[model samples]
Target: MAVEGGMKCVKFLVFFFNFIFWVCGVALIAIGIYVQVALGKALVVSGGSSAGTPVAILVLGVIIFFISFFGCCGAWKESYCMVTTFAVLLSIIFLVEIAAAIAGYVFKDKVRSVLKEGLQEAMNKYEEDPTLTEALDELQRKFKCCGANNYTDWANIKQFQANDTVPRSCCRINTTTCNVHPSPETVYEEGCQESIEAWMKKNILIVAAVALGIAFFEILGIIFACCLMRGIRSGYEVM
Candidate 1:
């Protein structure tokens, strides 16, 4: 009777944790989509060099979504094979995420240079590529800044040179009829590169925190799953 009661308790806990894990998988997918849609535009404008990050995130989210479904089913059914598979999948995910987190941290310093190069490339093509133009415009306007370095950087662009005007997105006010030659007081003197880099740094920290938290919980889930499996095996042995 005691053994049965203990097994029941283990089963319930395993099921509950697996359920939560499944929910997390769903959340990952949602977050991946959101990040891709939000940041993918800018990355795309950068000649697709940085596009892999978001795509990888989306792919990982999908894998987690499916693997977590297996985990939930395994826990609910108390199936040894399913539970074993879930354990392996979770372990793999944990390792992959840890590696990704490490790589992101290690390469954090290089992000600015890469972004600067990509943004410059996009800026040069801004007039030719409507999509790129819109993306750059949105970035500039939202960040309340201009050019990769400063408004003067726009002076070199052939299109801007021909028109003898910088993008209105550089203006502090409504851009349509804003100053063609902006003074320090009339427009943002700072460059978008600095603001964008700061914003990216803030987001990176946020992502790291969330990823670490998920990994910590994943460790617990793995323990619960293994314990439930052991309890099943022991119960069978006793029977």
Candidate 2:
């Protein structure tokens, strides 16, 4: 009877821990979502030309929190499947963050190179014929994707405060070395606009899937916590 009583006490403690974890998971999810799309909240600082916040980081943070919650529940209930699912989800979030950072670095270098080439080609085109102004405009549009603002673009301090929604790709970098124009202008380079638009569209689906996965785990955790608590209570009897 003593041994049986000890097991019941242990079960209660485990279930309580799992309940705490569930609360933490819910809190993390709430914070992440708020940071991502806090429409009503005032943005303390603007990220200039960026989609602004590190949305992927926010998403990954939420996922990790929920995974922990699920793990706690799984521990309480002794559900191996729930535990395994949490592990897998956590792994995916980590791997994706690493991959995305690497990709962003590599792609920034590529954008700079393409922009340099386009600038050179445009100068040549303009010099060929003063009357070839039409060609100059077309080439400007062509190089929009490979705009020079690859790395520092998002960190732009000055905003293109405009009524029209100008895509970030068109923003020109006002570097100290620039002799052409002292005041920077948002010049849409050839391909930058289209590329960002395409990337954003693709990114949406990826983000949605991750959010759903987190939600799923949170629900599972709640269910598991309830079951384990019930089991713990039932396990104890005066007999």
Which candidate leads in TM-score? Answer: 1
Candidate lDDT values, in order:
0.76, 0.45
List TM-score per model, in order: 0.87, 0.32
Point out the worst 10-residue segment of candidate 1 by lDDT: 230-239
Q: List model 2 lDDT by residue over 161-226, tens digit each.
A: 222222232336544332222223444433433443454466656655654554555455445444
Weakest ten-residue segment in model 2 by summed lDDT: 39-48
Candidate 2 lDDT (Cα, 0 to 1):
0.45
- Total clashing pairs in model 2: 13
| CA error at residue 102 for candidate 2, angstroms | 30
Q: Candidate 1 residues 38-85, lDDT tens each?
A: 676567655565777776776777887777778878877778889888
